[model samples]
Each structure stands twice: as C-alpha cells, then as structure tokens.
Target chain A: MKGAARTIGRDLGRIFQALAGLLFVSILVPLIWGEYYAIPALVVAGLVPFAVGYILTSRFRDAARPGKLHGMIIAALGWFCVAIFGSLPFLLIAWTVELAPPILGEPSQTSTLAAFTNPINAVFESMSGFTGTGLTMTDNEEVLPRTLQWWRSFIEWIGGVGVIVLTTAILARPGSGSLTLYESEARSERIHPSIVSTVQTIWWIFILFTFVSILLLWVVGMPLWGAINHGMTGLATGGFSITDNSIATYDSVAIDFALLPIMLLGSIAFPVHYLILQGDLRNLYSDLQTRWVFIYMGIGTVLLTVLVYVSDTYDSLFTAFRYGSFQFVSAATCAGFQTATDATNVALGRWSAQAQLTVVFGMVVGGAAGSTVGGIKLIRALTLLKGIRFRIADVFYPETAVRRLKINGRRLNEQEIRQEFEEAAIIAALWFLFLGLGTFALLIMLPQGEYTLENVIFEVASAQGNVGLSAGITGPESLPTLGKVMFLFNMWIGRLEIIPVLVTLRAVFDRGGLYR
Target chain B: MTVSDIPIVGDLLESGAEDRVFDSLLLAGPVLILVIAFLGRSTVTVGLAAAYVLFFVAYVLYLGVRR
Candidate 1:
C-alpha cells in the first residue's frame, strides 16, 4: 500500500517537471504579446506544479527511473497539465484585459473576449491546435492578436514533437528501459541505438525540413511570418492555418503544389529521415508503409479526380483534378489544410459519393508509420491487407497448411500476423466507435445546427485521426460547446494513439495493471 | 546518467539563452509591422521589417549553433 502511494507521488513529480519545462517554453508567447496578465498566469501555473512536484519527490529523487507504467502516466498527466495550463493565456487575456476598442475599417474586432474566452472554448482551441487536429471552436480567428495566434499554431509545433518524447529524449538517461518506453510511445525508429543521438538526429533533420519549407513558402510568395508558421505546423502535420480559409486563402496553384511535397514529406516516418541521412535512399522504396502510402495516395487521387471530373463540377477539367488531388493528398497525409470545401464543391451537385468515400478512405489510411500525422498508420494498413490475403489463401488450401504473410521483405508467421491484425482491428473499431458516439452526442447537443451525418463523422474522424480536414463544421463561431469538447477529447486521444487513455483509465479503475 | 550526460541537453539550454528582448523583436517582426501601422509610421515599419527579417536569418543561424 505504501509502495503504491509512493510510486504515484513519484510519477506525478516527474510529470510536473516535464510540464514545467513545456509550460516554460509555451509561456514565452504571452511575454511577447505584452499582456500584463500573462505574467501572473505563468507564475501561478508554473509554481503550483513546481511546488507540488518538489514536495512529492523531495524524499527520493534518485528513484526517478521511470518504467513503461510511469511513462504512460507521465504522458497522460503531462498532456492534461499542458492543455489545462496552456489555456491560461487565453482565459487571462479574455477575462482581465481589454485592449482598446477596434477602430473603423480594421479587419475585425481585435478581441471578442466576451464571446470566445470561456474555459471550455479556450481548452478546445488549445487542444485542437496541440493535437494538430485543426477543429477550431472560434471564428474571426484573424482578430486574435498575432502572439495568441502564434501560440495556437505553436502548440501544434510542440505537440507535434510531443512533450514526453522530448523529455525522454533530452532528460531521461538513455538505457534499454528508457528506449523501450520511448518506443512504446512510438518515437523509437532508432536512427541510432544511442537514444540521445537518435533524438538529435531526428530533430536535426526535422529542423532542416522546416528550413527548406520556410524557404519554399517564401519563394512561393507567402509572407515571412506566415511561411515560418506554416512550415512548423506543416512539418508537425498540425494544420492550423493563419488565414480563416486555410490553404484556400493562398488561391495559388503554385502554393497548392508546393504543399503536396511538404505534406508528403511530413507523412513519412522520422526513421526514414534517419535512413536517408545514413545515405540509404533505397530504404524509402523498400519500406512497406512508404509503398502503401503512395499507393493509397495515388489511388485516392485518381478515383477522387475521376469522380470530380465525371460529376462535371468545374468548367475546366484542370480545376477539378487540381482541387481533387490537393484535397485527396491533404486528407491522406493527414495535413488537413483544405484548398476547397466539400459543401461548395458538393453543392454544385457534381461531387459524387465516390469522391467523398475516397476522401474518407484516405483519412482512414492516414500517413506513414511513426509520423507526426495520425490515423491507424500505413504500416497497420499494409499488415492488415496482407493478413486478409493470407486468410484467403488459407481458406483455399487445406486447413492443416501453414501460412505466413510477408510485408515488405519480412515474412510474419501466423501469430505475428494475427497479433498485428488484432491491434489494427482494435484501433479501427475504437476509432469508429468514438466517431459514432461523438457524432450522436453532437447531434443531441446541437440539434438545430446545420451539421449533417457525413460532416459530423468527417469532423470527428478528422479529430480522431489528427487529420485537420473539415467539412466546414468546425470553427470558433460555428460549433457548439459540446461539439468542441468532443473534438478536444478526440484530439487528445488521437495523438496519444488512444491506448494511453485506456491505460490511464485502467490505472484509475483496475489498479492491477499498474504493476504490469 | 552521469555528469557527462548532463550536457546533451546543453544545446536547447544554450539556444534558449539569447537576449530575450532581442529575440522577442526578431520573433515579433509581423506584430511590429501591425504596431507600426497603428502608430502611423509605415515607412519606418517597412525598414524595420526588412531589418527584422535580416536579424531573423541570423537568429536561424544561431539556432543551428552547437554551443
């Protein structure tokens, strides 16, 4: 009993340290915003956790070698704390401070604190940004101060790399156990077995990508700040755009084309970056997930384009193909910067159900394995496909015949394939289950709102998959409070890949799993 | 982890140590433009904006430093 109590305290202490570091990094935004309220908020948020942690772990600081159990606890708790505290700036600014009233002919009102600054809305916005889900609960986002706006996109950038991954990568002592925990969080693709070196390599490559993206966006005529913000958000696969229409605001074919490469790059796993760094470019071709991702993207684009063309929505074939391909790639990569809205395109009565299905299918496949992008992941898709094939073959052969399915170059025995299938099945089932429940709940909450079954499912799926694509239902001024909360929970679970939430719940309820 | 392991996080630590005000200026180039527009100094805003971009380029280099 005593041991369990001590363990819980120790876990919270470590979690608090990680939260402090993240909060410290995030609080810089408010400082730049020059909101005087920010300082007190930061101080209170930082110190409360620091005090609790310092007191809890004061007795045995040396016992902080967090096992997987502790890792799960830290991740869940750390995310909860960050989201809660990250909301402070919004709440503080919304509540206490009143900037000068808007002058005439300004873009919009600078601060609609009365309408959008509630705790639920702030947390919803922060969660959407951090999870890279891009389901906003507020509108007139342009009116938000540049600093607060940056903070929203900035959360996505930080959340993209993940606080726990960064903590274990930077702070945790590298060892077999820590590496296992790191891999458990799915950050593992060890470019090098040395954990710190792996983290360094991954981040270094990520930074390189960010630089290239910024230069490309600038060259394509985006302003410098917009370029930098989009670069960070895009790399993280968190699609919070500065403009209200998202990528649609650019309206440039070049901009749309430029984002394809960026989204594709974002969708590939970090380990592939390591492989490329090690001068093994062929590994890209050899990767099962990479191959399937391309296949999915290509098939989805072609089919969606066909639907758009056949429906004759556009005067020109080029426009149909362009928008279709752009949206298909965006959904597939889970980089949900929409270049066109489904409603507008669909209202012409030109977009076929086939096109809609293709987009949803792309959303389900998501990006490559170990990516910042979300969904069941491409590797799971490939394995699940192979498992289905193996089952078909087994049905044809005698019951006694043994079958092994090969994915990429590796052949997996029945047990491995079954285990992989089970994992994929569980993920898919829970995903749709959550979507169904979320949609049903949203319908009950906002019965009079204009949400359709398809759009609601699409929004929930976008949140759950961490795919930021929307059917135009989610934005600050549009969605109800209950709808926003549902999306927030979806984003949090989506980023943690859902199991951590289950582990967290089980920890609270069935305490036996704490030892395991 | 030993004392030797402590410095692995040194890069983030060092990069975080730049003058906060200077760094804030570099980061706030966009915000600065909006402020200057409000202050009715569009010409000075443009010049400062150019300088801010230059400073930001230098800052990016600083980000790459291995101190």
Candidate 2:
C-alpha cells in the first residue's frame, strides 16, 4: 500500500511539475499584453503547484516504479489537480484584476473573465478546456483578457494531445513507467517503438500540423492571433476559440471550410499521420480507424444534411449541406466548432429532434480511438458492431466450430475475441448508463420546460463524450453549482475514458484506505 | 492478413481496386474544400457535390458486395 501511494504520488509530482512549466511559459502571454495585474496570479499558480510538486517528487523520487494501477491513479488524480491549478488563472484573473485596465480586445460591459471569479465556473471552464471539451462559462470569449483566452486555448492544445503524453514526451525521468501513464490517457498506438520516442514523435506530428493549420487559417483571412489559437486547438481537436461565437463569429465560409481539414487532421491517429508523413499515404484509406473517420464524415455529413433539409431547418439543400457538413465534422471529431445559424442555416438547438439526434450519434461515437477525441471511441464502436455480426454468424456454424474474430487488421482467437468484445461491451454499456444517469439528473436539475428531452440528452452526451456541442444547458447561469460540478466530473471521466476514474474512486472508497 | 472473414471491417482493406476508389473519395474531401476555399463554389460546387455523393455510393456498393 505504501509502495503504491509512494509511486502514484511521485508520478503525480511529475505531472504538476510539467503543468508548472506550462503555466510559467504562459506568463509570457500576459507579459506581451502588459497585463501586469494578471502576472501575480500566473506566478502564484505556477509557484504553488511547482512547490507542492517539488516537495512530493523530492520526497518520493526513490519510490518503487509505478505499476499500471498506480499509473491510472496518477492520471486520474493528476487531471483533477491540474484542473484545480488550471482554474487559478481564471479565478485569480477575474478576482484580482479589474476591467479598468482592460486586458485585450473590446471589453464587454460585464467582462467574460468575471464569470471565473466563482470557483465552480473557474474550475468548470478549466475542466472543459483541459478535457478538450469547448463548453465555455464565458458569455463572450472576445471580452476575456487575451491571457485568459490564450490560457483556454493553451490548455486545450496540450490537453488535446494530453498532459500525460506531453509529460511523458518531455518531463519524465528515463524509467518512470511512461508506458502505463501513456496508456492511462487512453493512448495506445505509438509512432515509435520506444515510449519516449513515441511521445516525442507524436508531439512532432502535433507541432507540424499545428503550424500548417495556423498558416492555412491565417491565409484564409483569420487574424494572426486567432489563427495561432485556433491552429493549436484545432489540430489538438480541442475546440476552444478566441472569437465571440467560435468559428461562427467569423461568418466566413472560407474559414469554416478551412477548419474542416484541420479538425479532420486532428481526428486521425498520430501513428497514421506518421506513416503518411513517412510516405505510406495508403494508411489514409487502409488504416481501419482512419478509413472510418472519413467515411463517417462523408456519410454523416450527407445524412445530416438530408435530415436538416427535410426538417426545414435550412432553406435549401446547399445551405443544409453547408451547416450539416461543418457541424457534423465538428461533432464527429468531437472538436465542437459550430457554424452560424444565419438566415439560411439553422442552429442545432432549434432543429427537429431527429436532426439533433443525428449529431448526438456522432458525438457518442467520436473520432479515431488513438486520436484526441473523447467518446466511446471508434475502435470500441467497431468492436461492438463486429462482435454482434460475429455472434450471429457463430450461430450458423457447428457447435464445435473453432471460433475466430478479426478487427482492423489483426485476427483474434476465441480468448482474445472474448476479452476484446468484453472491454468494448462494458465501456459502451457504462457509457450509456452514466449518460442515462446524467440526462436524468439534468432533466430534474435544468429549469422545467426550458429544454426538451433531446436537449438534455444532447448536453449530457456532449459532456460525457467530451464533445462540447452545447444545446443551451451549459453556462454559469445555465446550471446551478451542482450541475456545473456534474458536467466537470463527467468531462474528467470522459477524457480518462471512465475506467481510470472508476478505479480511482474504488481505490479511495475501498474499506482499506488509499495507503495502508 | 486474411481479410475475408471479418465482418464490416473486411469491406475496407479488401485490397487493390476497392482501395483505389476509396482513396479518391478520401482525397476528394480535403481537395474539395481547397477548391471551394479558393474559388467560391457556385453551380460547379453543387455539381461537384453530386459527383462526390455518387462516388461514395459507388465505393460502398462496390466493396460491400458479399463474397
């Protein structure tokens, strides 16, 4: 017990230390803006975590190497702590700095940054950002301080690739059980054989795409800063935006179309990206998850366009296609960028129940498994679908027939098939179970008659999926403290893919303590 | 890797002819955006969109055939 606690605590220290470095680097944002009032908060947020992390690691450095359970615990606890510290920037900036100096852009009458003064809102925004779920507490994103905006995007940027993956790539000591920690983030496919090299390669791929995305968005007429922010978040598939209404604020068909590829790039697994960059572009179609991502995007877009058009949500098929394609890709990738509900295109909340549910389907399935998306994931969805067909076919065979299953490219024997199917089945079952519970809670928690049943389900699915396409139930005013807390908890588990959070909970709730 | 016995996944990774057609559709998505982004799509956009749908349907039908 002591050994487990020691190792988990030590690994968590590394996580905090990495966060501190990121926080310190972020201080440059305020410095550039001459937002001196915000500097102390940034410094303190950095120092507190750094100091705490320093104490823990130095105290526990020589502890036993973390086993997988310890790694899971560290991941769960690390994200929880990171959200707390991550909220400090929002909380402190809102409380300490007034709008008198007015950090950047045209400050609103009531600054959006002020919403963060409430700890629940602060941490809620932090959790949403770090989980790469773009549900915002802020009413107007542009009115927030540039530092806060950058902080939101920055966390999403790192959080999309994952904090553990980043730490494993850079801050981890040579033999500190990087593999288990990496796996704890639900990341499995590696670009290289060595874990460290694999993470570093992932980062390189991330950085390369981020640069390209930024330039492309800029060339398409987004200002340089918005390009930079969106570029990071877009490629991370972390959908935080600096503008008022996300991509809708720009109202540019060019910008929306431009981001489509960026979002898609993010939705593909890093290993596939590596293979393509390494000249095996065939993986684009040949890789299982990659193929399905495009196929889903293609089919979902068309299906959604028809649904929207028939529902009379849009004026014409072309208009329906425009809104449908962008929104579907956004939801499907779990990136959550929205197109405007202009005169031609209707917003999702106002859509027919059938039209809205189509998007819910996309949100629930999400993008490729090894990518930054946060749902049940495509691989599990594939496994579940394939297993059903396998089961049906098995009935046709003889009772003593040798059973086999195959998924993606790998052939699986009976035991492997059972294990794989069980994992997928359990996760899918638990996903809908919690999703049901969340929807039920929100049905009670939300203001009566304000939202439909589908709206509540959409919001819960968005939160649980970590695909932040809000149907009007997320905001400081939108939900009470309990609801905000619930969504944040949902985002946390969703990003960790539920199991680690459950494990961490079970370990804590065990009759025996976390440590002996 | 034997592709025959796999259920839905087998339709993909079926090799040669099927993969080539599907790749065109995959490549088409991004390239179509580039076309619209540079030259704002008018009637040609709608026409291209129609062709895109055709390709998707054809690709599905082609590989979706039962062995």
- The TM-score, computed over Cα atoms with residue i paired to residue i, of candidate 2 is 0.86
- In candidate 2 the C-alpha lDDT for residue A200 amounts to 71
The residue ranges of model 1 lying beyond 4 angstroms of the native Cα positions read: A1-12, A26-60, A98-116, A341-353, A511-516, B1-67
Across residues B1-67, which tens digit of lDDT does each residue of candidate 2 receive?
5434565234222321234444344435556545655665366754664466455545444544421
lDDT values of the candidates?
A: 0.68, 0.82
Query: What are the per-residue Cα lDDT tens digits for candidate 1 across B1-67?
Result: 6322455333432222234433254235446545543664345644564465456446544544522
Which 10-residue span in candidate 1 chain A carries the lowest summed lDDT? A100-109
Candidate 1 lDDT by residue in tens digits, A256-308: 88778788888988887655544455656788777677777888888888788
Candidate 2 chain A: 10-residue stretch with minimal lDDT: A100-109
lDDT of residue A269 for candidate 2: 91
How well is each residue in A399-449 modelled by candidate 2, as lDDT tens digits? 999987878889999889999999999989989999999999988887899
Q: Chain A of model 1, TM-score against the native? A: 0.88
Return the lDDT, model 1, position A13: 64
> Model 2, residue A455: displacement in angstroms?
0.7
